[model samples]
Target: MTLEVHGMTEIQQLAGKDLGRSAWRTVSQELIDGFADVSGDHQWIHVDAQRAAAGPYSKTIAHGYMILSWGVPMFAELLTVSGVGRSLNYGVNTVRFPAPVPVGSRVRLHASVIDVQPVKNGGVQMVRGFTFEIEDCTKPACVAESITHFYP
Candidate 1:
């Protein structure tokens, strides 16, 4: 479920809030290939199914960055900010890929608002913790702390 917050006031009150998990999204070979095409990272382990079959993972794997980029859409499924002038992706504080996301796997995001601080111009800087959990996997595919600034 999405947690909708209207205006800066509601956003500011979200510190330490648990946003919960998002819907599962499948990782397809086509998606991986598209990412490779756009990123110019056509490594055989990611695009060549034939060779990847003999690789350690025994199949094509999605790029860590590709899964990281999905943070935007995945987060949108958990929270919605409204009545603000703008919401900007400030940056990522930390990120790590603990496990590979093999093709045909499913991933979901578990997000929490870790901190919210008042910034200049009456805006708030929110630090959100995101964990990209791969289905049926013991380790998470990626863990990251994303920062965003919301202006009134």
Candidate 2:
């Protein structure tokens, strides 16, 4: 279940809190292909399954950005702040890929609120730490500090 907060006051209290994880989602070749089409990144390791089979990971892998892109939907399973007029993606503060997410792998996000600060125009800026783990793997597919703005 997602954690809901009343307003800015409640959001402020969320800092330093680990919000838990999302459901395990599979990274299929179709998903990777779609991301490749949109991103124009048709690298063999990501799109050419046949070629990728003999490459680095021994199979196709999802693009790093595609794995990182999982943050929003995964975060949706974590927190929701009500009483806000609008919310905006303020981009990422930092991102790293410790391990690759091979196609057909199941992954999930474990997220937490790292920091919260007030921005102009009655909005609150927050830094959320997201760790996307490839199920059954020792390393994480991605670790990112994403920034967002919530307007009241």
Candidate 3:
């Protein structure tokens, strides 16, 4: 379920709040190969299953950036803001890939609001923390801090 907020003030109140986790999404080989094709990063560890079987992790793994890019969609599932004329993804502040997401692994995001501050033009800037976790695994696949701007 999404954490609904009506305005900037309500959004600010979510600071330090854990919005909650998203539904599990499986990482398929097709998805990885598609990312490799579009990104021009056909790394063996990510796309070559046969070769990666002998490599570390014993299987082809997903690209770190591929997992990192899921923050926007995943975060949308965690929260929604109303009464905004527009919203922009300001940028990413910090990112880490702590574990390999092997092909066929299920993953989900756990999100929290780190901070919120008013900006120019009656907008609010927010820093959100996202932990991309693998099912049944203790270590996360990726961790990222994303900044966003919402204008009323």
Could you list the CA RMSD of all candidates, in the order they appear?
A: 0.7, 0.8, 0.9
Full-model lDDT for every candidate: 0.96, 0.93, 0.93
Report the candidate with higher lDDT, 1 versus 3.
1
Cα deviation of 90, candidate 1, in Å: 0.7
Q: Specify the highest-TM-score model's number.
A: 1
lDDT of 3 by residue, 65-107 (tens): 9998888898889899998898999999999999999999999
Model 2 lDDT, full chain set: 0.93
lDDT of 1 at 82: 91
- What local lDDT score does residue 39 receive in model 3, on the 0 to 100 scale? 99
Candidate 3, which ten residues in sequence have the lowest lDDT sum?
A: 6-15
Any idea what lDDT model 3 has? 0.93
Worst 10 residues of 2 by lDDT: 6-15
Superposition TM-score, candidate 3 onto the true structure: 0.96
Can you tell me which runs of candidate 2 are displaced by over 4 Å? none
lDDT of 2 by residue, 13-88 (tens): 8989999999999999999999999999999999998999999899999999999998999998889889888889
